[model samples]
Target: MTKPTETGFSAPEFLTVDEAAALLRVNRKTLYELIRLTQLPGVLHIGRSIRIRRDALLAWRPGNGGPALGESR
Candidate 1:
């Protein structure tokens, strides 16, 4: 059986900077560095903060063909 979460606030698939860093197995600072260098994509700027789309991250994987969210490659 699975245990229920206590926080009650569910996390979104499209993660914020901190959350995306954790998912990508990189430090948040490193992610920022990547953004500065333009090594990565999906950088949506909604003010002073940067956000990476979950779909974009997943599509960047090898052989994915860079499709939109929920679209089969």
Candidate 2:
């Protein structure tokens, strides 16, 4: 389920790679690197598309310097 924002509009709980990258303020390549480094929480699967949770991204704070908590496999 999505959460309502200041505008009272909810955003999807899961975001595509492009949407996640834009929200993270990083290029797609960098986003992938972060996922690979396990610095950012990710949902991955074989023969399936990848998705990032909005809550995880919202919880992430730049410069905090810690691995995000979430299942990445």
Listed per model in order, the count of residue pairs whose N, CA or C atoms clash below 3 Å is 0, 0
**Cα misplacement distance, residue 46 of candidate 1 (Å):** 0.6
Full-model lDDT for every candidate: 0.69, 0.77
Q: What ranges in model 2 sit over 4 Å off?
A: 42-46, 64-73
Worst 10 residues of 1 by lDDT: 62-71
Best by lDDT: 2
Question: CA lDDT of 5 in candidate 1?
Answer: 44
lDDT of 1 by residue, 9-62 (tens): 554545688978888898988788767766567878889877787767767653
**Which residue runs of candidate 1 sit more than 4 Å off their true CA positions?**
1-13, 62-73
TM-scores vs. true structure, each candidate: 0.62, 0.72
Candidate 2 per-residue lDDT, tens place, 1-73, comes to: 7878889999998888899999878799888777777677655543667788888888877674554534344
Please report, as a residue range, the 10-residue window in candidate 2 with the lowest summed lDDT: 64-73
